[model samples]
Structures are given as C-alpha cells and as structure tokens.
Target: MSQKIGILTSGGDSPGLNAAIRGVGKSARGAYGMEVIGFRDGFRGLVEDRTVTLGGGALSGILTLGGTILGTSRDKPHKMPVGGEVRDMTDAIVETYRRHQLDALVCLGGGGTQKNALQLHQKGLRVLTLPKTIDNDVAMTDTTFGFDTALGIATDAIDRLHSTAHSHHRIIVVEVMGHRAGWLTLGAGIAGGADVILIPEIPYSVQTVADAIQERVRSGKPFSIVAVAEGAVTRDEHTAMAAALQRRETASSKEERKKAKAWIQRLEEESTDHTLRLAHQLESLTDLEARVTILGHLQRGGTPSAADRLLSTRLGTACADLIEQGVGGVMVAARGEGVEAVPLEEVAGQKKLVPADHPWIDSARRVGTSFGD
Candidate 1:
C-alpha cells in the first residue's frame, strides 16, 4: 500500500504557512505518489478527528498565499481544554492517528510546536516538524520561514515612522515581538536604521538610552527612533530575574522550586508594559516629546516575501523527501543554502538566541547604532 502522511500547523500563524503546506502536499502527492491529509486547527482537530484531503485542486495556487488553509491553533495534545476542563487528550490524539493509519505526521510551527511534536514522538508516533515563526528563535536552524516576512513588515514600519519622527522632531519608541529572543528586533533595528536598538540579549539602561538621544540632539538631529524587542528588560529587571532563576536552581524542595518559578513568571508578566514605561521615562529624562507604538500582531499578518516563499517551499519539499526516505522524529532545518534533518531532541525546549558578539551586532555598532547598553 502507498504511504499516507498527515499535516497540521500549530501555535501562532505566520506568513509562509500556506507555501510550506503546498510544498509538502504537492510534493508528497505529485512527486512521491503518496496520500496527504491535514488536521484542521492543530492538535484539537486531530483529537476531534477533523481533517481535509490535500489533493490536486486543494494544493493549487497556495504557494504564494499567506496563511494555512488547514488552519492552526495553540492547543497541546497532552493538556487540552475539553468538557469545560483541562485534561490530557494524548490518548485520544493517538487513537485518531491510528484510525487514519498515517505513516508519518508533519507539524509546522515554532518553539512550542517543536516541544509538542517531541511529546507525540515519545508516544511512539512517527513525527516530523518544520520551523515556522516570526521570532526566528527555533534552535538548530539557520532561519525560520515567517521571520523574513515579519522583518520586512517591521523594517517598512520603522522606515515610515522615520518621516514622522523627523517632521515632529520627537522620539518614537517602536516595540517588535520576539519572545525571550532578540533576533527579530535586532534584524529590524539595523535594517531600519534606528538610532538606538534594544534587545533582550542585552539588558538596557534608561539613562544610557537618554544619553544617546541627547547626543543625537546635540548633533542637530532633533528626532530619534528607538527599536526595542518586546522581551527586552531593564538592567535591574534582568538582574532580579537572574537572582530568581538562581533561587529556582538551588531550591531543594519541590515547593520551593515552584514558588521560585512563580516569582519568575510574575516578573515576566509585569514587564509587559515596559515599552510604554520606557517612553514616559525617556520623555522625563531627555525633556523630549516621546511617542510609543506597539506593533502587536501587525507583524504576523500579510503575504509571504519572495525569500520566505522560497525558503518555505524548499523546506516543505525537503520534508516530503525525508518522509519518502522513512525519516521520523526530526525537524527539517535550513542550513546554509541546503537543508538537514535535525533530531527533535536537539530542537525542543531550546532557543537560538542572538549572541552579543554576533557579526550583525558588530556591523550595527560600526554604523553608529547604539544598543542602549
């Protein structure tokens, strides 16, 4: 009998999801002569046994589309809300998998999805994953598909903001999304030519940022632009987090560890309004009119860029090739101008954080970009 594969998108949606889906479905069906089906709305759909066949017509014309036709959700198979209560639904998902007799299952998503795929793999289901996130923080991969499109959108937004900042002679603080990683904010900050860029990798000082803006004002540049990552933290906050993490690591009892973990979580939750506070602080310190703009979810929408489409298609087809070769429990990672199958163990629960001494940071510094360090 011919092989059959299942596909699903999990977590937050990004721009190049459809391209990846088409690349996998078309290549699997047309090139490998295999049957392909997609689970709707991610793991919830799989638990409910909801599906859609990816035949000729369904796969056509989606290569340049923005989102997934199969839809997506952030539901986890092991901990899903069913019957008004959060319950373990892994067994139900496993039953659905067996009912469909899938030879392999492909999951397209970001960090959380990778970890979730690992759980399914441990359940003895043949599982593979693809990197898909605007954050670009997936480990063991050169880059994720949704990142390029998001970077373009963020850069364009910053470019447009420059005109208004210059006209009004004011400070504009722009927030970009990258949960606990600085790749997206750093890339867009440099590409957009922002005067000061702050990322989570480097804890920023408010006084340092104010000094940078004042220096620009002294140089006759009356307006300034600040690009900050959503996860970026003040130096004091970073220090406090480090201490809390240390406490968690050193805690002897489970109760103590749990308490430390909750403290860390609360600290992170409180930092959600950091960007707005940053604007107010800057205005007070620098005596300049400051404005804040939060690019929330705006970066996730829109069509995939040419580079993203190419990357998505490349990874998708490569996933088909691996499925044909009987590979499982791996992620189709993008290497330099090629693709590689990385073990799921190496990808799950890990993040590809931007290094302080990365070449991009050096280049940006050389071009007079201040990181507010």
Candidate 2:
C-alpha cells in the first residue's frame, strides 16, 4: 500500500496557498505514488472529520491561483470551539488521524500554525509544516512563500500613490501590514521610494517625520510619502508599551496579570489606527495636506507572483519528499536557493524581525530616506 499524507492550510489566507497545495498534491501522487488527503478549514476539519481525497484532476491548473482550495481557519487542535465553548479537541483529532491511518500530516501556515503543529507532534502525530505567511516573520526561513507576492502588491500600491501625492503636494501616509516585525513594510517602502519609512523595529517620532517633510519642502520638494507598518509605534508609545509589559511580567497575582494583559491588548488594538493619527500629526506640524491610505487586506489578495509560485512549488515538493521519508516535527523552510527542514521547536514562537543595522536599513539611510528616528 502507498503511504498516506494529510495536509491542511491554517491561519490567515495568502496568495500562494493554492499553488502550494497543487505542488504538494501533484508531487506526492506522481513522484512518490502516495495517497494525498486534505483537511478542510484547518484543525476544525480534523476535529469534525471533514476531508477530501486528492486526485490529479483536482490539482490541475492551480499553480497561479490565489488562496487555498481546502480552506483554512485559526482553530487550534487543543482548544477549539465546541458546543458553544472552547474545549480540548486533540483527542478527537488524533482519533481522526488513526481512522485515516496517515503516515504524516503536513501543515501549511505561519507562526501560529507552527505552534499548533508542534502541539500535534507532541500528541504522537507525525507533523510537517510549510511557512506560508505574507508577513515573512516565520523564523528559520529565508522568506516565506506568500511574502514575495504580497510585497509586489504592496509596492505597486505605493508606486501608484506617488502621482496623487505629487499632484496635490500632499504628505501621503501609507500603512502596510506588519505588527511585531517590519519586513513587509520595509521592503515595500524601500522598493516604492517612500520619503519616510517607519517600521515597528525602529520606534519613530511624529516630530522627526514632520522635520523630514519640512526638509523636503525646503529642498523644493512639495510632497512626501511615509510608508509605515501598521504596528509602527511612536517613541512615546513604545516606552509606555515597555512599561505595560514590565507590569505584566512582574505581576504577583493572577488577577493583576490578567488586568495587565487586557490593558496591553487594548493598547495594541488602538494602535491599529495609528496611520490616521500620523496623518493628522503630519498635517499639523508640516502645514501640508496629509492623507492616510491603509492597504489593509489588499496586500493578501490577488494572484500569486511568479517568484511566490516558484517558492511554494519548491517548498511543496520538499514537503512531499520529507513526508515520504517519515520526517515529522519540522518545517520545510526556504534557505538561500535551497530548502531545509528546521525543527518545529526552533521555529515556533520565534520571529524574524528586521535588525537595526540590517543591509536594507543601511541602504535606506544612505539614500537620504527618513526613518522618523
């Protein structure tokens, strides 16, 4: 009998998910003569026992398509909503795995998915994972599969906004997605020629940004572009956040810890609209008409770019090879022009944040770009 492998895409959807599924399904069936099974809506499907058998026809003509066909969700195998309450669903999932007799389970998703996969592995299920977030924050991978496509999309949006910013002599604040890390915003801002690029890694100041805009105006440039990560906080906010986290970490009681955690979460939620406030601050300080354009989920949609498709296919094929060899508890990560399997323990709960002195930051600084530092 052929070896059996089950796969699922979890967490937020990205552009290259479909191509990845096609790559894994085709290669598993054709190259290794393995049986491919897909779980629907991530761990929820595994708990509810919903699945589909993959054949060659189902995997056809899907390389350029966007999103996952099997669908996805953020449900965790250990704690899932059941009967109107969150309950442990691991036993149910493990039973489903036994019924299907899968030799290996391949999970394709971002950081949270890696954590979930690690838990499943601890439950004695063989698990392999693929990095699939546009954030490119997954550690151990040179870059995630969906990041290239989203970067292109975000860069194009920034490129198209230059004309309006120039025409109206407006300071355009463009918000791109990146909460804990700034890879997406940094890449797009540099590629799009943003005048002031503010990232989460480098705390920014509204006054510093205004100064840069004023300097641009002094240089006969009437307009400016500020590409900011959604999570980019001002220096003041960053200090406040550090204090809040310290309070949380040092809380002596569970109640105090809970309150601190809630306060921190509220702060993060409020920070979601940071761009709008930034625009107003710029307008007030620079005396220029400032506008905020939030890219939001637009960066996650559309067809996968050529680079993303190639990356997903390569990772997918590598995943299949690993599955055939009974490899588990690892993530198929993209290295430089090659693929490698990194232990889930090393990947989970880790982030690949941009360093202060990264080459990209150096290049941006040398180009006379302002980081609002």
Candidate 3:
C-alpha cells in the first residue's frame, strides 16, 4: 500500500495557502505515488477525523488562490476549547494519526502551527511543516509565502493614499499588519515613498514625526504619508495594540477592568504625547491639515503575488521531500540561497524582525524617510 500523508493548515489564514496545499498534494500523489488527505479547519478537523481525499482534479487550478482549501483556525492542541473548558488535544491528535494510518503529516502555517507540529512529532507522529505567514516572522526563513502578496497590497494602498494626501494636503496614517515585526510596514512604506514609517522594533515620538512632516511642508510638500505597523508604539512603549484592544473587549472582571483602564491610560498618554497629538500640535504650530487612515484587514486579504506563488510552491515541495525523508519535528525554511529544514522549536515563539542596521533601513534613511524618532 502506498503511504498516506495527511495535510492541514492551522492558525490565521493567508494568501498562497491553497497554492501550497495544491503543490504538496500534487507532488505527493502524482510524483511520489502517495495518497494525500486534507483535514479541514486545521488540527480540529484532524482530531475529529473529518478529512477529504485530495488528489486528481481536486488539487487543480489553485496556484493563484488566496486562501486555504483545507481551511484553518487559531486553535492550539494543548489549549483547545471543548464544551466550556479548554482541554489538551495532544493525545487525541495522536489517536487520529494512528486511526488514519498516515505515514506522515504535512502542516502549513506560521509560528503557532509550527509549534503544534513539533508537539505532535514529540508524540511520535511523523510531521513536516511549511512556513506560511504575511508577517514573514518565522525564524530561519528569509521570507515566507504570503508576505509578498500582503506587501504588494499594502504598498498599493499607500500609493493611493499619497495621491489623496497630496490633493487634500492631509497626513494619511496608513496602518498595516505586523504585530511582532515591521516587515509589511517597512517594505510598503519604503516602496510607496511614505514620509514616515513606524514599526514595533523601533518606537517613535509624536514630536519627531511632526517635525518631519513640518519639514516636508517647509519644502513645499505639505502632504505626508505615515506607514505604521498595527503594533507600532510611541516612545511611551505599549506592545501589541491589537492584543490590547482584544483584552479591552474581554474585560469584565475587576482585575481585567483595572488592567484595561491602565492599558487605555497608557495608550492615551502615549498618543497624547506623540504623533496624533503632535499632528494636531503641528497644525497649530505649522498650520498643516492632518488626517488618519487605518488600513487594517485590507492588507491581509488579497490574491498572492507572483513571488508568493513561487515561494509557496518551493516550500510546499520541500515539505513533501522532508516527509519522504522521514524528517519530523522540522519546518522547511528558505534560507539565503536554498531551502533548509529547521527544528520547529527554534521557530516557534520566536520572530524575525528587521535589523536596525539593515541596508534597507539605511536606504530608507538615505531617501529621507523618517522613523519618527
């Protein structure tokens, strides 16, 4: 009997996921003569034994697709919700692996999925992971599949904002994804020719940003584009603004209320002391109109770019090769020149951020891009 490989996508969905799935499934079944099975809605479907045969025409025409055919979820194996309580599903996952008679399992996702794949491998199931995330924060990989597509979307948004800002003489604040890293914001800002760029790795002050915009106005360029990561902080330094918002949404307890209030206070103080405050201050000081535009999910939803499609195809192929080689507890990552397998432990809970002294940063600075500090 041919070996059967089970495939699934976990964590947040991204463009090129379906392409990766098709790449792996087609190569596994057609080239290796292996059977491919897909688990829906991530590991949850695997634990529940909900699978669909993935081969033949089913895997066709998905190279340019934007989402996963296998679907995905943010559910973790150890903290999976069941009934009203969170339960560990590690054992259940192992049981399902045995029940399905899978020779190896191919997992596709970012950091969280890689961690789960590692845990599953520790439980004695053969596993291989393909890195996937718009953040491009997976360690060991120079870049991931969905990042290029997202960067393209974000850059286009910034470019459009430039025209509007020029016409209305407004300070457009375009927010992009990247909670832990600033790859999206930095890439888009530089490519879109934004006046100021803010990332999580670097904190900025409102006065600094305002000064840059004011200088632009003095140079007869009154309009300014500020590209900011969703997690980008002012000098006061609060992390994960999105997470903070989510926490505020779930704040019901007194302790939660206290923490939420503190978070809000910190955010307000930082904003009041920084760019938004500084923008209004600049208007009073320099008389330039400023406006904010948050490009939240617009960056995350889109068709995969050509680069992303090629990268996803390569990573997916590497995943199947790793599985065939009996490599478990590893993630297929693209290094400088070629692809290599990195231990999942090294990738999970770790993020690859833009280096402060990187040439890209130097280039951005040389071109007069202000980091707001």
Candidate 4:
C-alpha cells in the first residue's frame, strides 16, 4: 500500500498557503508515489474526518494562488466541538490518522499552528510544520512565506500616502501589520520612504515624534510620513496615558464600560490611533495639521509575490523531506540559504523580535529614518 500523508492549513490565511500545499502534494505524490489527502478547515476537519484526495488537476496551477484551497481555521484540536459540546479532540485526531493509515501529516501555518502541531505530536502523530505568517514573527525561520507579499502591499500603500501627505501638507500615518516584530513596518517604511517608523521593539515618545515632524518642517519639508505597527506602544511618557484609560475603564458605569471597551479595542487595532494620538498631542503642543490613514486589511489581501512563492515552495519541499526522513514534531525553518528543521518546542511561545542592532535597522537609521524614540 502506498504511504498516506494528510495536509492542512491553519491559523490566519496568507497568500502563499496554497503554494505550500501544492508543493507538498505535488512532490509527495509525483516524486515519492505517496497518497496526499487535504484536511479542510485545519484540525477541525481532521477531527471531523473532512478530507479530500489531492492529485491531478486538484494541485494544478496553484503556485501563485493567494489562499489555501484546503481552507483554514483558528480552532485548536484540544478545544474542538463534538456533537453540541466542546471536547478534547486530540484522541480523535490520532484516531483519524490511524483510520486513514497516514504515515505522516504536514501542517502549514504560523506560530499558533506550530504549537498545536507540537501538542498533536506529543499525542504520537508524525508531523512536519511549514511556517506561514505575514508577521514573520515565528522564530527559527529567517523569513516566513507571506511576509514579502505583505511588505510589498504596505510599501505600495505608503508610497501612495506620500502624494496625499504632500498635497495636503499634513502628517500621514500609515499603519501596517506587525504585532511584536517590526519586519513589515521596517521594510515597508524604508521602501516607502517613511519619515518616521514605529515598532513594538522600539518605544517612542509623542513629543519626540512631534519634534521629528517639526524638524522636517523646519528644514522646509512641511509634510511627514509615519509608519507604525499595530502593537507599537508609546514611550514611557505615555505610560500614564494608558493608565488613565485603564482607570476610566474601572470607574465607568455599566453602560460606560461598553463604550470604554469599544474605545480600548479601537486603540488596540488602530495604528492610526498611535500616530493620531501623538499627532493630537503634537498639535496641542506645536499646532500642526496631523492626519492618519490606516491601511487595514489591504496588507493582508493580495497575490503572493515571486519571493513569497519561491520561499513557500522551498519551505514546503523541506517539510516533505523532513517527513520522509522520519522527523516528527519539527518545524522546517529557513536559516540563510539552507533550510533547517527546528524542534517545535523551541519555536512555540517564543517570538523572533527585531534586534536593536540589526543591519536593516542600522541601514534605516543611516538613511535618516527616525524610529520616533
């Protein structure tokens, strides 16, 4: 009997997910003569036995596709629902592996997917992981597949913002996606020629940001561009600002609590708020017209770039190789030119944040980009 391999895409969907799936399916079936089956909607499909045979026209022309054909979900196997009640589906997942007689399983997703894969492995399933996130926050991997595409999208948005900021002579803040890491914002900011870039790794003061804009204005450049990440926080001076909001939340009445929660949610999601709040503070302090433009969801939707397609293909192929080598509970990661399989334990819960002295960051600094510190 031919070896059977099950594959699934999980967590937030990205552009290169289909490419990775196609790579694994085509290589495993054509090269190794193995049977490839795709699990629909992540681990939920596996638990529910929702699978489809993958071969022939099913995997054709998917290298440049934007999302996974297998679908994806954020649901965890441990918390999967059974009938009408939530139940631990780990044993069910293992049972499905036995029912299908799968020799190995390929999981393609970001950090959260890797964590769940690790847990499944502990339950005795042979598994290999392919890193897939726009954030590129997964450790061990040099760069995840979808990051390049997201960077391109964010860069284009920033480039377009330049004309609007210049035309109106106002400060334009373009927010991009990056929770803890600044890879997307940093790369896009540099490519887009942002005057100031803010990231979670480096905290910034509102006054310093306002001063940077003022300095640009003083130099006859009346307009400025600020690129900020979603999770970017203000410097220590704004510690009291967040504290004041928290205090209001605590003291608010029941109806006021709902409003406070909504405001907090907006602050959490809005990269513009980070800059707008700073801009408003700057206006009060220096009187400048500051505006914010949020490039929400625009960064997440698009065709995968050539770089991302190639990277996803490489990672997918590496994952198949690892499984063939009987390597289980490992995430295939890109080091430099070569790919390495790192233990999932080392990758889960740990994030790869931007180092202060990274070469790219140094280059950004050399190019006169302020980090708003």
Candidate 5:
C-alpha cells in the first residue's frame, strides 16, 4: 500500500501557492508513488471533511498559477467558528484525519499557519509546513515563497510613481505591507531607490523624514520618494507601543490585561492612517505637494515570478522527500543553496526580523537613503 498524504493552505493567499501545491502533488504521485488529496479552505475543510483528489490531471498546468486551487481560510482548528459560535473542532479534524488515514499532512502558510500546524502536531498528528508569505518573515527560513513576486510588484509600483513625483516636484509616500516585520518594505525600498525608507524595525521620526526630503530639495532635487512599511511607526508611537506591550506581558489581572489590549488597539488604529498623516507632515515641513499611494493587495495578485515559482517548487518537493523519509513535525525551510527540515517547535511563535546592522541596511544607507531614524 502506497503512503497517502493530505495538503491544505492556511492564512493569507499568495502568488506561488498553486505552484507549491503542484510541486508536492506531482512529486508525491510520480517520484514517490504516493497518493495525495487536498483539503479545501484550510483547517475548516478538514473539520468539515471537504476534500479533492490530486491525481495527475489535477496537478498539471498549475506551475504559474497565483493562488491555491484548494482555497484557504484563516480559521483555527481549536477555536474555529462553527454554525454561529466559536467551537473547538479539533476532535472533528482528528476524526477526519483518521478516516482518511493520511500518513502525513502538509500545510502551506506563513507565521500564523506555522503556529497552528504546531498545535496539530501536539495532538499527535504528523504535520509539516511550508512557508509562503509575501512578508518573508517566517523564522528559520532563508526566504519564503511569494516574497519575490510581491517584491517585484512593489518595486515596479515605486518605479512608476517616480515619474509623477519628479514631474510634479511632489513628495510621494508609498506604503507596502509587511505586518509587524520590515523585510518587504526594506527590500522594496532599496530596490525601488526610494529617498526615504521607513520600516517597523527602525522607529522613525517625522521630523527626520522631513529633513531628509528638505535636504534633497536643497540639493536641486525638488521631488522625493518615500517607501514605508504599513506597520512603520513614529519614534514616539513606537515607545508607547512598546510600553503597552510590556504591560500586557506583565499584567497581573484580567482588568490590567484588558486595558493593555485596548491601548494597543488604539495605537494600531492610529497606525492604519499613518501614510496619509506622513504625507501631510512632509508637505507642511518641506512646503512641497505630497501624495500617498498604498500598494495594498496589488502586491499579492499576479502570476508567480520565476524566482517565486522556483522557490515554491523547491520547497514543495523537499516537503515530499521529507514525508517519504518518515519525517514529521517540521517545516521545509530554504537554506542558502538547499533545504532543511527545521523542527516546527523552533519555527512556531518566532518571527524572522531584519537586523539593524544587516548588509541590506548598510547598502541602502550608502546609497543616500534615510531610514528616518
């Protein structure tokens, strides 16, 4: 009897998901002669016993597809929304797993998905994960699939915006998504040649950003482009946010925790409109017309780039190889030139953050980019 495996995509969808799926399905069926089935809408489908068989025809021609054919959702097994109320549906999922008799379950997602996969592993189910976030913030991996495609999209947007900024002599502030991490914004900013680059890793000052733009103006350049991460914060806001998070971590009572949560929520709400606020501040300080552009989901849509497709296929096939070797409870991490089966415990609940002294940061600084620090 050939080994049978199940696959699902969880959390946010990305450009290379389908390629990754195709890689796993094709390799499992051809190289290892293993049977494969996909769960729809992530863990929710497992709970509901929704599935699709991944035969040869099902895996064909998905190498350049953008999203997952199996679909995805943000639902967690332990606290999933069933009917109307939230319920622990882990038992239902385990029952379905037993019914299918899967030798291993492959999950493709980002940081949250890693944590959720770890939970399933603790329940005594064989689980493996593949990192697939545009943010590229999954811990223990050199780079995640979907990031290269999104980086190209973001860089192109910034490149196009430069024309209007230069023509109108305007300060253009472009926001890129990365949640709490700065990899996306930092890489795009450097690649796009933005004058001011801001990310969550480096708390910035509005005054410093203004000064940088003003200095460019004094140097006979009246227009400047600013690349900012959506989670980028002013120095003052960062200080307050850090203090609130500390309070939440050390809270002794429910009421204290509640207060801390509210404080953090308020800060996040304020941060949501940070791009517009930044443009306004820059206009006031530099006396230049300012514009804002948010490359929101635009970065997440499109066929996978060549780099992304290659990485997805690499990780996905490595996942199949690990499962064939009876490996369980690990993520198929991309090392420098090869892959590694990193234990899920090391990856879950951890985020890969850019170091302040990283070579990328130094290179950006050398090219006259200001981080507004």
Candidate 6:
C-alpha cells in the first residue's frame, strides 16, 4: 500500500497557504498515489484527532485561496489548552500519528511552526516543513511564501499615504507590520520613496527623524512620509533591550534567569502604540502636524502575489517529492531558482535577521533615505 501523509498549518494565517497545500496534496495524491490526511487547527487538531482526508477534489482550485483549507491555530504541542488548563499533548499527538499510519507529517507555517515541527521530528516521526510568514524571517529560506503579498500590500499603503501627506503638509508616520524583523517596513519604505524609514534591525532616534524632516522642509519638501516597522524602537530602548537579553542569556542562577526572562516579556508587551508615541514626539520636535496610520492586519489580508503563488507552488511540489521518498526532519527551503531540503535542526527556533550591510540597506542609504540612526 502507498504511504499515508499528514499536513497542518500553524501560527498566524498568511496568504498563499492554500496554494502551498494544494501543491503538496495534489502531487502526493495524484502523482505519488499517497493518502493525504489533513489535521485542522495546527497541533491542537492533531492532539484531538480532528482531520479531513485530502483527496484530489479537496485540493483542487485552491491555488489562489487566501488561507489554509485545513484551517490553522497557534496551539503548541506541549502546551495547548486542554479543557480549562494547559497540557502537554505530545504523546497524544504521537498516538494520533501512529493510529493514522502516517508515513510523514508536513507542517506549513513560519518560524514558530518550524520549531514545533522540530519537536515532532525529535519524537521520531517523519516531518517536513514549509516556510510561511509575511515577516520573511524564517532562517535558511530566500523568502517565505506570504512575504511578497504582504510587502506589496504595505507598499501600496505607503504609496496611497503619500498623497494625504502631501496635501496636509503633515508628517505622516505609516507603520507597517513586523514584530521583530523590519523586512516589510524597509521594503515598502524604499519602494514607496519615503523620506525616512525606521526598522527594528537598526536602532533609531526620534530626534534624528525629526531633524531629517526639518531638512526636507527647508529643501522645499513640505511633507514627509516616515515608514516605521511596528517593532522599531528608539536607540535608548534598544540599548535597554540588549542589556536585558544579555542578562537573560548570561544569568548566573536559575532565579536570576527567570527574572530576566520576565523582564524581557514585559518589555515586549509594552510596545503597543509605539508608532503613535513616535508620531507625537516628532510633532513636538519638528513643529509640524504629525499623523499615524498603522497598516495592522491589512498586510496579512490579501490575495497572494504572483511571486508568492509561484514560490508556494514550487515549495509545495518539492515537499510532495520529498515525502514520496520518505524524507523527514527537513524544511523545503527556497534557494535561488530551485528548492532545497534543509535539516530542521538548522531552521528550528532560528531567525533570519537583516544584516547591517545587506544590499537593501546599502541601496537605501545611497539613495539618501534616512534610517533615523
């Protein structure tokens, strides 16, 4: 008998997930003649044994769909809400896997999904993952599937914001989505020709941003568009964050480490409306009217771009091929024009941050864009 394959999506929903699912399911069922089982709501569904058999009909015409067909959730295997309390359901998940006779489990998601898939891989089950995040911060891949669509949405928002900024002669601070990495903000900022761009990768100063706007005003440009990543922080805040992380990473005692970890989580939770605060600060410093427009979920809701569709299809088909061979513990990573199966160990729990000297940053600098550094 042919092997039975399982698939699930985890973490935040992204554009092109359906396309990836279709790519994998169609190939697995049609070409390789495998029985495809789709677990719903991520790891939670696996623990609860909720699934749908994905035949060719179920996978058809979903290439342009926006979300996963099997559905998705943020539940982790080790700590998901079971009844009223959190519980470790890894053994339950393994039981489900064994009961279903799955030859391999395919996971589609971002960085966190990769980590969770790694946990499953360690449990001695065959596992494969696909990179799927708008942040494009999954380590080892050229770019994740949803990033192109999100980037285009953010760029279009910035393009639209330019007209209002020009009309009001105001400093319009347009915040883009990116929790830790600034790929979305930086890309849209450059593409939209913003006067100033602030990203989380580089620490920035509000005063520097204000001074740049003032310079633009003196040079006959009355309006300024400041593109900021949601997670971008002031230089001083970045300094404190670095110190806290160092403490957490180098604590001499378990109690000290726990305290530092708590502090770090607190710092992250307090970052709400950071863009609004920056806008007000710039208004005071530059003596200009300032407005804030946060592009929140607008970035995450959209039709997948042509590039994203192509990438998802490519990675998805590659996943099916690997599953046919019973390969496991690897993420199907996009490398140049082709795909490569990277070991999950190299991808799990790792972040692909923008380097200081990345070409994108250099180009932005050479074109006279201010990073507010």
Better of 3 and 5 by lDDT: 5
Cα lDDT of model 3 by residue, 1-373, tens digit: 6789999999888888988998888878777789999999998998788999997888988887788888889889888998899999989899999998999999899988888888898888888888898998988889988899899999888988888999998888777887769999999999999999998788887778888988998899978998888767776555456567779889889899789878877775555334355456556655678776777676667688998888888888877777777777888898765789888778877878999998888999999999987
Highest lDDT: give the candidate number: 1
Worst window of 10 by summed lDDT in candidate 4? 235-244
Candidate 2, superposed: residue stretches over 4 Å from native: none
TM-score of each: 0.98, 0.98, 0.89, 0.89, 0.99, 0.98
User: What TM-score does candidate 4 reach?
Assistant: 0.89
With candidate 6 superimposed using the best TM-score fit, by how many Å does residue 331's alpha carbon deviate from the native? 0.2
Please report the TM-score between candidate 3 and the true structure: 0.89
Candidate 3's displacement at residue 323, Å, is: 1.6
**lDDT (0 to 1) per candidate:** 0.95, 0.93, 0.84, 0.85, 0.94, 0.92
- Of the two candidates 1 and 4, the one with more favorable lDDT, higher being better, is 1
| Candidate 5 lDDT over residue span 1-373, tens digit each | 7899999999999999999999899888999999999999999999999999999888999898898899999999999988899999988888999999999999999999999999889999999999999999999999999999999999999999999999999999999999989999999999999999999999999999999999998999999999999989999999999999999999999999999999999989988899999999889999999999999999998899999999999999999999899999999999987999999999999999889999999999999999998
Give per-residue CA lDDT, model 2, range 184-298, as digits (tens): 9999999999999999999998999999999999999999999999889999989989998999999999999999999899888888778898899899999999988989898
Which is better, 2 or 3, measured by lDDT? 2
- For all predictions, the C-alpha RMSD in Å is 0.9, 0.9, 4.7, 4.7, 0.8, 1.1
Which ranges of candidate 5 are over 4 A from the true structure? none
In model 6, the runs with Cα more than 4 Å from the true position are none
lDDT of 6 by residue, 91-136 (tens): 9999999999889999999999998999989999899999999999
Q: Candidate 2: global Cα-lDDT?
A: 0.93
Error of 3 at 7 (Å): 0.7
